[model samples]
Target: MDSPSSSTGPQPIVNSRPGGRRRSILSDFLSDSLPQPSSFLSTSPGIAREILTQDIAECSSSDDDDEQAAASDAESASGPADAKLAFHPNGIVWGAGCSLVPTHSRDRPVPNPHEVEESLHAELSLLRDNAILPPKHRRPRTTNAFARLYRRNFSTKVRDHEGPIVPDVAVETTPMLREIPPTPGPEEIERRFEFAVAHHEIRTTWQREAKTLIQYSTPLIATFLMHYSVTIGSVLTVGRLGLVELAAVNLATMTASITCYVPVQGLATCLDTLCAQAYGSGHKHLVGLQAQRMTWLLWILMVPIALLWWFSEPILAALVPSKETASLAATFLRVLIAGMPGVAMLESGKRFVQSQGLFKATTYALMMGAPLSFLQNWLFVFKFGWGFVGAAAAMAITQNLLPLLLVLYVWLVDGSRCWNGFSRKALRNWGPMIKLALPGMIMIEAQFSVLEVLTLCAGQFGTSQLAAQSILVTVTSTSFNIPFPLAIATSTRVANLIGADLSQAAKVTAKVSIIAACMVGCFNLLLFTTFRDLLPRIFTDDVEVIRIASQALLVCGVMQVFDAIAAVAHGLLRGIGQQAIGSYANLFSYYLVALPISLSTAFALGWRLTGLWAGITVGLLCVSVIELAYLHQTDWEVAAAQAADRLRSEDVAEVKLRRHSHSSYHMEV
Candidate 1:
């Protein structure tokens, strides 16, 4: 019998005897010699067999006699013994003959060697002539499953040999398994980061910033509107008494706002910087103490302010020509004096609540007070015939109610977490509070005084002009309420960020606030310009007042844009503890630039109310430009460090004060 190595390729051996031992042996040699199916053919068994048969047939015809004899000898060795089969590269079966018995199994009869050899040779020749082989270049790619499996399992390399595809040990392995992707290097990661920054970073940042501004600004704007509504409701209620009453009450309200109310409000604003920074630094208790200090300071200051209101008659007489109007305005101021403390307290509470981001509490309190003030006015002025004094009394009641309700809410509701009751420490820290409060007060008072100066100029224009100016001022003040709260929100947010040591975030917040302020200004400009003619009808029926007020409104429309910018920029300055900068800007713009121009244009140039507003416009523009420039050039990192230092100093002060108090208590014991 021939050795297994003599087999040239895979072939079936058939016994030709009548009762032949019909067994077959599968040899590994035949599988090793035969061509493997392509990956494409392995997935389609019928096509693979047909192609294989055709290629093998063609190869067999061209093969030499020595090769044929070797195939025949290998087939003759598959007698009674079972053969171990090798798998094709494509995992197909190589031999298709009947099972052969083991050499020790004596029950099976052996087939004739010569007959088996001849039968196998004949079968081999037929299969060789009928089979087909695909070209090497046309083989399956590395991505194919069958090709990968074949490459992994096979020891021999698949290659073309003498016009037929065969397994050869000489060729290097063609790696069929897919190569693993390499990990991204630092350079690649950096490149991707740069791409994101260049393309999407700014847009994402702006969107987040705008959303944050809107979130904080919206509730604050609503709160301002509600607070302003109390005053407006009183104005509307008292207007029904007569034009003289309206003019008198309006003048008194403006005067009081400039001298008393504005200064108190400004003093309370010191809490904006201190409380906001304290809250951001996680010193929540300090925010409450700071607010308490402001409340005490404003109350102390209100003593002098109350005297001013009591003697308002002479001041009004000096400013205006009419004795009757001066007396009426003084009466209005005296009645309004009852609420001045409440206004100051309310402002302090508002700063405290705003620092803790509890804006809704203030909004709800004012919302309740605004309509209630109107109802009280209607009852006192119209129902009881108390006249302009009754309007002032009703407004006082409502204003006082605002602080009471806000204080109750803070003590009982969400904001109580920051409160540790009123501490003696509040009384001891007057220096720091006064330092910030004085500049903030000056900054705010300077701006309000510009309007007061213009109003004084308008009084010189006669009753019609004065009445028109009152209406215009009231309308502009109401509209100014829109951007005013945005400023407060901006200050709170910027201070919080700075105190938290997020300097870049604070800078970005300032920029976004400025942009928002400008946009609001543009919107106000459109609303004021569009409604200029119609808005005066709500305040008065006099044709001359309406005409003059409408013209003034046009100038106000332009001024609102600058007012919006200045308001927000002022808030940014306060956020970084730079209230002195705003104070200086307001002093320079309103006093040096605005007041002189307003006097010249109103008195010298005879431009009347329009010139007054024009001068105010120029002042606002100057303040806005200067504040915006300072904000743009400021180093946020330095500002953050300053905020930290302020907090640390306060802490040190508290520690020293506590030690002194403890030592004094021990000595007393």
Candidate 2:
């Protein structure tokens, strides 16, 4: 044999017996006669098996094996041969050399199996004793049956390929042969665990807030829808009476809404800030007292409003073109005056319950009241022939019952914990409530006055136009009930967050509310736009009214988006105790920006009813823009602090009033 060339790298060891093929160096070295105990390689059995299998597969595929053997024989004849061996111990190669001994005989004596076994055992013991081999427990575990099967199939496929190529004999260390990576340290383990926990917590908090918003808003929206049905029912009943009656009732209803109903409703919203903050801060008793104070204040305010309703004919006459229409509207207003207190009281009770997060009670009360009011309208207007007067009476009676039902539910069913019973102390805290109520009242009044002005302008177009305007306003207002409760819920939820001193949470709530409102606005736009031709027919069957109202409905479809934005923004301001800013924005937008545009378009430019609505649209757009801009710039942390201060200041004032009362009593005694 000739010495293997140095540049040939490692060669596979072959069995020199007559028909035996080449085998891997690892298996050959283990099977060969060792010169000494130290000459044997040490490696895991699994790796040794893999290397053997790979080399055998490569040798089986080579066509040049005969040529290589002939070249080796020529080299052997020309020069003295040395055997070069490459040992792979645990898959790491180590170079070695040994002299070759040639045998001319065809047969060589086979090594005894017993002697070979003893030699292998002796070599393993020596390696273990010398610490050259790893301890048994430290060795890598062998591959299971699945891994062996995969390797067998893979090797079979690689060997059967038909090609002209030289096979390379090399054992590349794979992942199986490499040392196992060290276990992670305690610090890294802790860091990974903490990251997992934080990720879970963030996911959980988001789900919780989403659930809370849904739970709070759903019942509120339902309640608003039910309550709005009462107004729709009235409009539908009055429409059956005749065109003049429908126009009269619509005019009176809108006027009352602006002058009496909305003002009280606006004034009562002060409870949203007061009662919501009180309940959230755990001053539960203050919630009830705030409710009572709102009731008293609203009742007092209702005095002048009743006078306005009684004398509304002259007002309507001056604004409306038809004297008969004004007289019918006045009659309707006078009938509704008796129910103004009921409306005020009902709103106060609603705020009190809503502040405590008892939205379901409001929903239940409105559900009952809406149907009963509708039934009563059918009975009084259609069955008993009470006409517009019956519609107003039915509404007044239902309105009176609504507050009583809400109050009874709150006191007897749930929310009694917040009520300390009726208290004179509620009557004493007028100044603080008024301070908050005034700005809110101003903001609401400005918007309502714009609608009233638009209604007046619509009246100038004629009875048919006025009837159409009424139908459009009623439909739009009904649609408005959807986003309105969202605004109320936003206010309550934001106030609660502020009262709890969760500044970032309040900001998030505000943003979520605005986005939700805009989505609802889009929905309303689509709804009204799709049904513009059909919706007016619900209130009136008159062809002319339907045609005129359809045109105005288009304007309403565009306006609803801006209206929703402004409504929610106003609610946010109330929540953050910034009602004055909303008031100013409303004043400027409605009076300066919207009113002039509306007047010039409807009268000077002759756009009529459509132009009036166009003007209203411009006002709503201005208010929405201004208020949203202000909201974007607000610092929620400061707003939260202000809410806290507002609650504390009221407490301080209550204390001073008590002290003064006690001193006066002592002096008198």
Candidate 3:
């Protein structure tokens, strides 16, 4: 009796795949596996099981012409012994049933039904397959056929990520997502709300955190372009004025990049990390108030930024003996000053929105802002009498004012209620904001200050070498900064995961992002090396400018690997909320080590641009090596431990819910 059962058992088993003899058990599988409620659990258990069991094969095939190709393809589900279907983790079809690549199919026969096998990957009849009775109960169907079972993962994909908990009320609906519990403290709610409202000010600020970050970071690559192109174009326009004028531009830009631009980037990044955690937690009042605080703080920073422009004339006059150079430098400062307030606001507003997770909008702003700035530069410098001053002014008008105004208008117009809530009360709880935002700000501010010392030290090398350094640094920064957006994406994604208490998922995402950055590094290195000589010509027509720039670029060629690693680490830090440590690391490595090393090499060792770039390389290398090592060894367990805490707090509620529902009703024990 058992012999026949073994011999004939697999005949229907082979036919169990979708569209294979329309097995009745398919309905039961559908009912059991499709995430239905208890009420409907019994209604169509058999029918549900049958449909689902057979649905894989039952899913419609390709159009007439494509079916053969799909059927005959070595990786298709129905391929022969020599030709197995490629198995995709995401299933065979993503959209419209188009077969995806890289699937794995096996040639094994189905196991005997009554005999149980024990392997995670082993295929046995699940609810849907086992629901229907044997041949004794069913109408006769084909008997001996291939019983090779397609392995099905019967368990639901349990959520692997938990976003940061806040006043956990409503969350954006996502697949297999677990709801974040509301923050435990009433104070947290108020603080978060204030920050959101401040950043979302309808008429004044109104930027979401995510969108703002994207807007600012997306421009990083473009700014690198601006530094290089303007340096080149400015050199040409200053041709009649002489090398001193060109050198003035290099020095001013160096000062700006290190002191104003990059630090501002780091400082505003405070908004990115703090606002995100605060907002994700959904303490609405805190968001509004905190955003205002951040805004005002950055506003005060404008004093120094403006002072940099105002005092620029005298500084250049003292640094360079050339009268024309000093005069031109003063003029550049005036124009930069006019735009300084707006630039700072734009950065501030942008970060406020980005911290809320609006990356798409932020990127769009850059798409709009870059072209306008470039256009103004051409019009003011080349088309008008202003020359370098005109170009510089144009950049200010396009980049500084435009980005600020647009982002501000968006926040004000759309997020009006969010704007009106600012007050001193929101500032009262300084602890969390300081804990989250200050570390990042210090890290960024210190990073820029160090870069400033290095660049200024290089300025002593004269216009050509400084100009070459600027161009080389600009290129390397721009090329590798392409990974910045991905990093931002990674950080936010990981933060949400961490908040959701999904440590494993956070790790995977971080690893993938690092991998992506390294790949980008490879491409950048190749690009710089392949076009090393020609790359500089795009920035300047002067033979000397191009010559020195090329040599620096050649050395800068291999710098991408380290740069990519460091940048990604910075992003990972932001994501994991390790802002202070990263800040400390930047301060320690760049200032304590790289800057001094570069200074010694350039001045003491008699190296010029090579020594300067070598310093940058060494600084970044030190930062990268230490940062990456820390990132790899990060103790994700602390985050995992949060799960136990969550359970300790929320699990009791779940039990009470079950008990309450059970007590008040006729439900059985």
Candidate 4:
């Protein structure tokens, strides 16, 4: 939300400095808060109406007779003016019945292990005093169900969630025009366009796509936090059990997560994008059909997945170093994997619902899952004699319970029946889905592979290094997610636009997404740059790890823009069903290029961790650059023609099939 500013003295009173030298707190806060004072102050005079009444009251409380004595309180309250904001130290600027948070502070300082614990007491008090979210809404949102569980017992409903919660809007919204032009005058339209462009450039310099950045990047942050939450619990419970338990738990989680999730997530995007497209095109059946296929596919996948669950220990042994690890990983993996069906169902169901613009379902499901997962984890790991295995079981058990119920819940609501009547066309829709899906899968695989190598490399440095790497990885992952939700939203928009025959608008939306990503990337770059030294202390006190992690942050931090570009490019293409291209880019970048280079550098060249990180840089940079270039060179008109051609081909294929009176694959399975 802010960066440390040089002191701006308090506002001038009647007896204050004669030269107006005591700069108003306004100078500290607003001067820094506004993108450009000249434009923002008058650009939208009504903005003052939108200030949070609570924040205003908090600010207005400054009339406390001893306000001057609490100037530090004032400064702290007004910290958004100058002090650099991180996720923990949220800053707000309040005065004159208004509050300003220059940005959603993305820098999450890794807390020392005890700091979070200490905060728990205060958090508990708040919980005791404050109101809970509506009982129906009290559960965590779907995307975050598992993680939210960690905070359930310790957390209160009192603290506001950091992200912008999309409240249910009952007002009718049917694609209304959203243009709010700069205060217009005799200014030429073209000139006005130029001016708007220039103004955007300047303001965006300090702020990225603040909203979008926060949206997409929150997942990454959540990922980082997830590692910590799991690690904190595991380490506390398992650390005393010895290194073997720790290693076993880690290995078990990794193998299952990589095998279970990475590919699944990539493949699931098809549902997200296609469903969005179908919804946009008003082809209701496609959305439901795709969801059914995905659900059935999960069922099919579950057979093999459950087998692995049955044999999880051996798999852990194969992947990790120790027999003890094998035993530990296997024990945990089995339980966790048992929950795999639920996890898959939950995710797929969410994508289905989210695609159909029923975002509430996903949120509601998460709300339920969070506390349940946490309580389960606690009981199994701590109360039961399960150790790391118990922790894993907790996760699995809760996971297992959620999905089937959700499926049935939706079905009971007539969702399942909605897909009952499948047209013959519904029986034959796999080709395009797979074609558009592979690239995303490839990218996910490539990324997970990179992470595996990096984790392995970090292993050589010892546990502290691994923990630090995990910490930073979590931070960046979480930060990067700032744009991801936006990317998802953008994908939906792109599908809608493309479906509606607005190719140019689709292109514009893609461009808008990229620009938004870059701006977010830039702001985050600034955040990491400013807080590089501060972030390492959050995880551990090991001085060597801090120094090493800080250096890694420096090198890796600058590449976020490239990552942003690459990710959004992939998202855009996939939305248009050009997934294989992005997949290929990912494959080439990570496998044919980054892997070899980074491995050789880290191991062969003796560059150590730097080499490992450099590889990620090279791969991501190459991917981003080449992908952007490809996007730039895209001939959408030709592509649009090709879309029509493909549809024509499908039509012909359908006609031939009907003419031949061929049977379908519906009976095969």
How does each model score on TM-score?
0.62, 0.62, 0.58, 0.55
lDDT tens string, model 4, 513-550? 77677887788788877888887665445576668778
Off by over 4 Å in 2: 1-212, 272-297, 352-357, 415-436, 490-514, 571-579, 631-669
Global lDDT of model 2 = 0.60
Top-down TM-score ranking: 1, 2, 3, 4
- Please, what are the lDDT tens digits per residue for candidate 2 over residues 1-669? 111121111221111345432221122113433221111111112221222222223222333432332342353334311100100010000000000000000000111122223323322322232233333333333445554443333221111112222333444446665554443333433343234323321011122233445655566566656777777788899998788888898898888877877677667756655655444333455567678878988888889888988987888999999998899999988998888878888778876776555646766777788889999999999899887899989988988988888888976898776676776666674765676567556656665677777788888888888898889877777777666666655665565555545454455556567767789889989998999998988888888889988888888899889878887787776566565566678778878988888889989998888888888789888888776666654545455556556556544543443344334334544
What lDDT does each candidate get? 0.59, 0.60, 0.46, 0.48
Residue-level lDDT of model 1, residues 1-669, one tens digit each, is: 121112111221111245422111112112222232111100111221222222223223322322432343354333422110100001000010000000000000112232223323322222222221112232333345555454433312212111323344343255643333443433343343334323322111233345555765676556656667777777776666666666687788888887877677666655655665444333455567678878888888888888988988988989987677778889988998899878777878877776665646776787677778888988898889887888999988987998898888877787876676766666764664566567546656655666777777788777678878878777877777767667655665565555545454454566667778889899989998999999888877878878998988999899989988887777777666675577678778888988888888878998899889888889889898777666554556555556567656554543443344334334544
Candidate maximizing lDDT: 2
**What is the total number of backbone clashes in candidate 3?**
83
Note the residue pairs that clash in candidate 2: none
Rank order (by lDDT, best first): 2, 1, 4, 3
Name the weakest run of 10 consecutive residues (lDDT summed) in model 2: 96-105
Listing every candidate in turn, what is its Cα RMSD in Å to the true structure after a full C-alpha superposition?
37.4, 35.3, 22.6, 21.6
Lowest summed-lDDT stretch of 10 residues in model 4? Answer: 92-101
Per-residue CA lDDT of model 3 for 1-669, tens digit only, reads 111122113221112244322222113212322321111001111221122112212222213212322322223222111101111101001100000001111111111111111110111111112221111122122222221110111111111011111232344445434333332232333333234323421110011122323443455445334333433444444443445556666666666655666555555544543443233222223335556665666667778778777877777667655556567767776777776666566665654544333323444555566566666666676677677777567656755655564465557543332343446553344444444444444544556565456556656766677656556655664565466544544554455444334454455455556666678778888898889888776666668877887777766766676677666666666555564455566667777877777788889998777776677777777777666665544555354344335434433543443244323322321
TM-score of 4: 0.55
* Candidate 3 regions with alpha-carbon error over 4 angstroms: 1-242, 262-293, 320-326, 355-357, 404-413, 421-439, 642-669
Clash count list over all predictions: 17, 0, 83, 28
